[model samples]
Structures are given as C-alpha cells and as structure tokens.
Target: MIVETPQLILRPVGTNDVSALVELDSDPAVMRYVSGGAPTPRAVIEDWVVPRAVAELSSRRGGGMWVALDRSNGAFVGWFSLRAPRHGTQPELELTYRLRRAAWGRGLATEGSQTLMRVAFDAPDTGRVFASTMAVNSASRRVMEKSGMRLTALHLGDNAETDGYERGEVEYELRRSDWESARFVWAVRGSTSELTA
Candidate 1:
C-alpha cells in the first residue's frame, strides 16, 4: 500500500493486476473519455500498457503511474499517477487519474491526487507536479483544483490534433512553494482553537 487514501490504495500495478486491468480497461464507460470512443484492446494492455507501467515503477525517480484500488472491497477502481514523460527532455511531471465510471462522484480522485502531491513534495528534492486535461474534462479539472494545483497554462495538445486538441487543453500545476503554503494553511486550520477569553 504505497498510498492509502480514504477510499482507495495507490500501489504498484504488478503482473497480478493483469486480470483486473483487463476488466477495468475493457469497460466502455471507463474508457469513454480517454479513447473518446473505444475500449483499450487486450493486446494494448498485454504488450504495452502494463509493461510500460511496470517499467515506470523501476525508475530511480519516485514518479510513476500507480494502480488505484477501492478501499472497501479491494476492487480495482482505476489508476492515478504523476509521471515524468519518457522523452526526459522536460523535467515536468504529468499528473493523471482514471477511475471506473461507477467510482465517479465519490471524492476518491481528489483524495488520491492529494496523496500524490504529498509524496512528491515529501521527496528529498522536489520540483512541480502538474496535470492537464481536455478543457471539457470538468471532473478531472475539479480533482486537480481540489489537490491544490492551479491552472497554469492552456495550449493545443500535440495529439489533440486527433482528440479535438484544436479546441485546447489546460494544464494545472502545483509548485513546491504553493504546496508548502497549503500545508501551512491546513496546519493552521487544524491547530486553531476556539477562543474563550
């Protein structure tokens, strides 16, 4: 259990996860917003997705995609992550999350995202963690906002060329300084005591 949220677990997605991944990734509703129309094929899951995810876990950097599981029944809810792109030219981390449609509206996404930021800032040396989404992905944007990340920029996605990127994409970022401030704010709220004097 790398990260334990109120209703989810962020852990390594290992070989044992193949079945669950297959089932979750096959769900039409779950992949709707992602692929825009199609389910993730098993071939993609077997030969690419899972293997690539595991490879990320092997990196020296703490950033990598993680499996998110339901705390109640231990079922696979989906996945969330803050990963540095493979190109390595940019140091920026990409924040991401995807959960089963049934898991929507439960606040699990926000809880899991906040935990990722905590882990990132807690690391020995930290930079920034940002997540981007289709401007239309209000749900994801809400999670990013709730995690204390703010909208930093808007751009036409490279691949948005196909996914209607021409419309635009939004990036939300949380810097170490900002996270530190939020921590202080939370600490203050948690510490404030009612005055009786």
Candidate 2:
C-alpha cells in the first residue's frame, strides 16, 4: 500500500484489478470528461489500460495509479494517480482521480489526492504537482483547490465528446517549495497532527 486514510486504502493497481477497472470505465459519466462521453471498451481496458498501468507502477519512481478500497468493506471505490504526462519526459507530475458514481459527492478524491501530493513533495528530487480538467468539471476543480493547487493555465483543445469543451480546459499546479513551507507552518501550529487529508 502506498498510503492509508481513515476511510480508504491506496495501493498499486495490478492485472488482477482489470475487472474492477473495466466496470469503472464502463460508466458513461465516469468517462465523460476523459473520452468526451464514450464508455471505455473492455478490450481497451484489458489490452491497453491495464498493461500500461502495471508498467507505469513498476517503472515510475514517484507515482502511479492506486486502487482505492473502502476501509470498512474492501470495495473498489475507484483509482487515483500522480505521474508525468503520457508522452513527456518532464519531471513534473499530474494528479488524477476517477471514482464510481456511488463514490461521488464524498471527500474521497480530496483525501486520496492530498496523500499523493505529500508523497510527491516529500521525495527530495520531486518538482511541481499539477492537475487538469475541463473548465466545466467543477467537482474535480474543487478537489484540486481544496488540496492547495491554484489556477496555472488555460489550454484550448479539440474535445468532441461533448459540447462542454467549448469552454476549454484549466490546469492547476503547486510547487514543492510551497508545499514544504505549508507543511512547516502546519507543523509549527501543531495542526499537522489533526490534519485528516
């Protein structure tokens, strides 16, 4: 396990998790922002997503997708990731999360993301942590904001999955130095011990 919270367990995802992943991606709403509204097919999950996820977990030094499990019942809630962009060699990492519809409206996304950011910034050589989403994805934007990220950029792209992309996409970022400073302040204030996310 990479990290554990009062309500969730974050662990490296493996081949055995294929079924759970397929089910999650099969939901139209879950894949809305990613595929422009198309549910990911099972063959793609088995042939591409699963293998790529497993390889990334094994090779990435500071990040990978983690399966989120409910602490009480051990159900697969969803998955979260902190890693470099798919086609880039930059050291910067991107934060991402996708949960089942049943898990929406809860704070699980923020909780898991906070844990990953800690891991990211604490690694001595780590750089900035970033996250991006469609401008209309207010729920995800809130999670990034609550985790201490701020607006960094606006990227215009061709997203035909839905008309929502007409508003463009937004990126949020947090530097390691800033996060470290905040950690120091929380430590001095003795609030670190009480922090949940």
Candidate 3:
C-alpha cells in the first residue's frame, strides 16, 4: 500500500530499504532512545527486520510498516508503522515512527502519525490507536500529542541497562469515538468556512 501527505510519500518497505534502514539505525543520535546509541547491525536489518516487514505487508493484518520519503526529492526520511498489539486484541493497533536525524524538528513525525491514525480509524474495525515512548523523549511525546493521542498510562522501568529506561515509558491513545467526534467538528468548521467564503 501507498500513502501520501503534502510533504511525504509512504510506501511498503522492501529489500531495497535494508541499507537505508541500517544507515538510519546506525546514527547514535537516532538510536539513542531505542538502543542507547548502539547501532543496529546490518545483518539484523537484512535478515530479520526486512523479512518481518515484508511478511507484515503480505499478511495485511493491521497496517504494516511504511518507508517515508521526501515528496520533493524522494529522500529516505524514515519509517512509520501501525501493527497489531503484541499483547492486545485486534482493532487496537500500535503506532510507531523512526526518522533520520535530519527529519527531526520538522514535524514530519507528527504528519506521518496523524495520517496513519486517520488510516486506522477509517477502517470500520479499528477501535483505538496507541503509541509508547520513553518518558524522557519529549520530542516523541509531543508528536503523539500533536497526533491527537492522550496519555493513558505510565509504565515503570524494568531494565536499567537500556537508555532512557530509567525514566520509564509513557503510553498514549486515541479512541475511535474521540477520533470520530474530532473529525466531525473539523468537517463542520470546514463547511462553515466554505459557506462564509
């Protein structure tokens, strides 16, 4: 599947993205919150990450991973995913995004996340969309809030060795009912503006 926003084009990840994924994970800054600045080995991306993404895409169970690209120049910006919850049932997908350092502070993460949330809720079966990040990762928290998800829980840390793990994790969620209400308000306001115009 393919999706587009004004600033990005998101498509299913493939073998071609292995190198790009490696480069993205290689940046200590990019992986700071994820792996405590340890670069993901290229072999992992090739053997495990890419294959899993491919399988997710093929299964079409919940939304899979999508590689985000710059609309103007087609640069590899990052990847976004909405997948079935590991510990939860269907219709409750988890949202996630990982972008290159160059993409930070550009609002691209929020843009992509908002788009995916819409995609999830557009499906009649989807009941909720949620995400989690290290509590210390203010940037990611802001992205989740900007995407209309509210903080639902705070998970205590269990692994001191993990970077940012000492600070714990925050979970955010948007329910289908809330999303529908917000969309309705936007639709009404849009029509009002058009009528006034």
Candidate 4:
C-alpha cells in the first residue's frame, strides 16, 4: 500500500530498502532508545527484518511497516508501523515509528503517526490504536499525544540491561469511539467556518 502526506510518501518496505534500513539503524543516536546505542547488525536486517516486513505486507493483515520518504526529494526519512501487538488481540493495533536523527524536531513523526491512526480508525474492525516507548523518551511521548492517543499503561522493564529500563515503558491508546467523536467535531467546526465565511 502507498500512503502520502504533505511531506512524506510511505510505501511498503522491500528488499531494496535493506541498505537504507541498515544505515538508519546504524546511527547510535537513532538506536539509543532501542538498543542502548548498539547498531543493528546488517545480517539481521537483511536476513530477518526486511523479509518479515515483506511477509507481513502480503499477509493481508490490517497493518504493516511502511518506509517513509521525503516527498520533495525522495530521501529516506525513516519508517512507521501499525500492526498487531505481539501479545495483544485483534481490534487493537500497535503504532510505532523511528526516524533518522535528521528528521527529528520537524514534526514528521507526529504527522505520519496521525495519518496512520486515521487509516486504522477507518476500518470498522479497528477498535483501538496504541503505541509504546521508553518513559524517558519525552519526544516520542509527545508524538503520541499529538496523534490523539492517551496514556493507558506503564510497564516495568523486564531486562535490566536495556537502557532506561529503570524508568519503564509507557503505552498510549486512542479508541475508535474517541476518534469518531473528534472527527465529528472537526467536521462541525469546518462547516461553521464555511458558513461564517
């Protein structure tokens, strides 16, 4: 599937994205929160990550990972995902993203996240959309909030070796009912503006 936003073009990840993915993950700053600044081995990305994403794309599942590109220049910015949680049931998908350090502070994460949430809520079967991040990662938490998800849970880290494990993890979620209500309000506000004009 292809999804476009004002500043990004998102497409299903493929073998061609291997190098870019590796480069993105190789940056210590980019992977700081994920792997304690360790670069993901290229073999792991090539032999596992890309193939799994390709398989998930073809699985006819409601969600999969998408590589994000800068619309004007086609630069690889990062990737975003909306997929079933490893231990969670249907109607509740997980939202997650990782952008190049260069892409930070530009609001691209929040923009892509908000768009993906809309896509999730468009499907009648999707009852909730959720995301999780290290509690100390205030930037990611802001993206979740800007995308309209509310804090729902805090999970203690299971591994002491992981960075920021002591602070734990935070999960945020947006329910279908809440999304619909927000859409209605936006529609009404737009209509009122048009009438006034």
Candidate 5:
C-alpha cells in the first residue's frame, strides 16, 4: 500500500488494473465531468491510460497515480493522483481524483484528498498542492474546498466539451506554509474540524 486512510488504501496503478480501469471509464456518470459525457474506449484504457499510469508510478517524478481501494473488503473504489507540475519538476504539484459511481456522495473524495494533502505538505521540498476542475463541476469544487484548498484563479479556455465553457476552469491551491500553520492549530485544538473553522 502506498498510503492508507482509515477507510481507503492507496496503491500504485499497475498493468493488471486495465480491466478495472476500463470498468471505471465505462461509466457515463463517472465520466460525466471528463471526456464530454462519453465513456472512454477500452482500447484507450489499455493502450494509453494504463501505460501512462504505470510509467508515472515507475518514474516517481512525484506522488504518481494511485488506485483507491476499500480497506475493509478490499474492493476497488476509485483512483487519486498527485503529479508533478505540467512544465517541469518543481515544488508545486497537481492533485486529482476519480471515483466509481457507487463511491459518490460518501465523502471519500474529501477523505482521500485530505490524506494526499498531508503527504504533499509533509515533504520538505513541496511548496504547494493544487487542483483544477470545470467551473460547473461543483461536486469536485466542493471536495477541493473541504480539503483546505482556496480558490486561486479561473482560466478561460477552449473547453467547449464542458458545460460551463463561458465561465471557464477554476483552480484551487493550498500552500505548504498555510497547511503547516493550520496543522499546528489543529494539533493544539485536538480536532480536525478546527482546521476548517
């Protein structure tokens, strides 16, 4: 296991996960926020996505990609990712997650994200962790906020495939310094809720 939360186990995405990944990408509701509501092709999962995930894990350029599993029953729940900055290796990284429809509305996103945030900030070289989503993807936006990220920017782009192209995409960020300060307070308060309060 790469990282384990109370209810979830994060493991590296491996070549054997192609079928599970295909099952995930084949759900319309799960793919709604991605791929313009179309299920990703199985060939795409086998030939492209799986290879990339495997390579990312092997490179360890950053946290790489992970598969989320239920701790109790050992079922596949979803996947989460922490990747290096788009341009190059840097102290900043990107956070992302996707879940099986069955896992929706269960607070698993926030839980897994909180775990990732802790890992990200714990690294001495990490300066910030960031995430982005379509402006209309309120569910994902809420996850970012609950994970302690603040809205940082909105980028207008050619996201014609998404519903809210006019409003563009939204970026959320949490600096290591801000997380450290809040963590200290949480330690003192002896409650996780105090971090948000």
Candidate 6:
C-alpha cells in the first residue's frame, strides 16, 4: 500500500491491474454517468489510463492517483486521484474518482476523495483541487462538497455522446486555505490520519 487511511489502502497501479481496470471501466452501470451509458473499450483503457497514470506518477514524484483497496477484505473498490490541472491557472489540481456502482452511497467516494486531497496538497506544486461533474451528477457533487470543495462554477458543456446533457458541467474548488479548515475540523473529531499540505 502506498498510503493507508483509517479504512482504505491506496496502492500503486501495477500492470496486473489492467484487466481489473478494464472490467471496472466496462461495467455499464459504472460507466453510465461517465460516458452517457456506453462502456469504455479495453483498447481505450490501455491507450488512456496506463501511460497517463505512469506519467502522472513520474512527474509528481510518486504521488499519482491510486487504486483503492478495502483494508478489511482487500477488495478492489475504485480509484481516486488529484491531478495537476493540465490547464495552467490558479495552482489547481483536479479531483476525480470512479467506483463500482455497488459502492455508491457508502461514503467511499468521500473517504477516498479526502485522502487524495491530502495527498495532492502534500505535494510541492499543488495549491488547490477542483472537481467537475455533470450538474445532474448530484452524488458526485455531494462528494466534492463533502471533501471540502466548494461550488465555483456551472457552464454549458457540449457533450456529443450524452444526448441532452449538453447544458453543461459544474465545477467545484477547494483551496489550500480551506483545506486547512477542513483538517482542523477533522482533527477535532479525533481523526488518526494526518492531513498534509
């Protein structure tokens, strides 16, 4: 495990995980909200997920987004990441997550997101983290807010695949200043893990 939380262990993505990631990404139920209901092709997963992830890890000095495993049973749950925004502005990273539909409503998204936020801010180049999702993606929106990101903007996004979803995307942001406030709140509650950056 690269990092351990109260209930999760974040492990580096290895070559052995490609099949599982392909399976996860291919779950129609899991991919519904992401790709307007179509499953991601295995070739796309290889062409996209692997090299991009290796690149992120290499550049971040080993602080790449991670594959989350269950601490209790060692189950593959999902992946969470805090990526330096490719768009150059405001020192912001992007927070992202994808979990099995079965994992929904279990607070796993919130847990993993908060952990990734810490990991992100712990790094040298990251100053803020943002999350974006379809405005209709309320569950994802809630997790973003729950992880300390605040609603910043909502704009029209032309997504050719999602039929009528073209109205736009909503974005939320969490700066290092507010992250400190969040950690303070968690500390008061007796959290065992330390918040970094």
Model 5 quality (TM-score): 0.89
Worst 10 residues of 2 by lDDT: 188-197
* lDDT ranking, high to low: 3, 4, 2, 5, 6, 1
**lDDT of all predictions, in order shown?**
0.75, 0.83, 0.86, 0.85, 0.82, 0.78
Q: Which ten residues in a row have the lowest lDDT in candidate 1?
A: 188-197
lDDT tens string, model 4, 1-197?
79888789989998899999999999999988788888999999999878877776675556778999999999999999888766766677788899999999998998899888877776667899989989999999999998888999999887677778789999999998898787777787784211111
* Local distance difference test, candidate 2: 0.83
- Clash pairs, candidate 5, are none
Best by lDDT: 3
Residues 51-107 of candidate 6 have per-residue lDDT tens digits of 677677888532466888888899998888766656665666788889977678888
Query: How do the predictions measure up, each by TM-score?
Result: 0.86, 0.92, 0.92, 0.91, 0.89, 0.88
**Candidate 1 — number of clashing residue pairs?**
1
- Pitting candidate 1 against candidate 6, the one with the higher TM-score is 6
Report the lDDT tens digits of candidate 5 across residue range 1-197.
Answer: 38887788999888788889888888888887786678888888788777776776565445677899999899999899887765766688789999999999988899889888876665577789999988889999999999889999998869677666667889999998889887878888787542332
lDDT by residue (1-197, candidate 1, tens digit) is: 37776677789777777777778777766665566646777778878877877776676456767889888898888888767777766545677888887889998888888887876666545578888887877888898888888998998666642455556789899887777877777776783211100
* Cα lDDT of model 3 by residue, 31-102, tens digit: 888888889999999998788778866765557889999999999999998877657765788898999998
Better of 1 and 2 by TM-score: 2
- Model 2 pairs in collision: none
- Which structure is stronger by lDDT: 3 or 5? 3
Q: After superposition, how far is residue 115 of candidate 4 from its true place, in Å?
A: 0.7
**Which candidate, 2 or 5, would have the higher TM-score against the true structure?**
2
State model 4's lDDT. 0.85
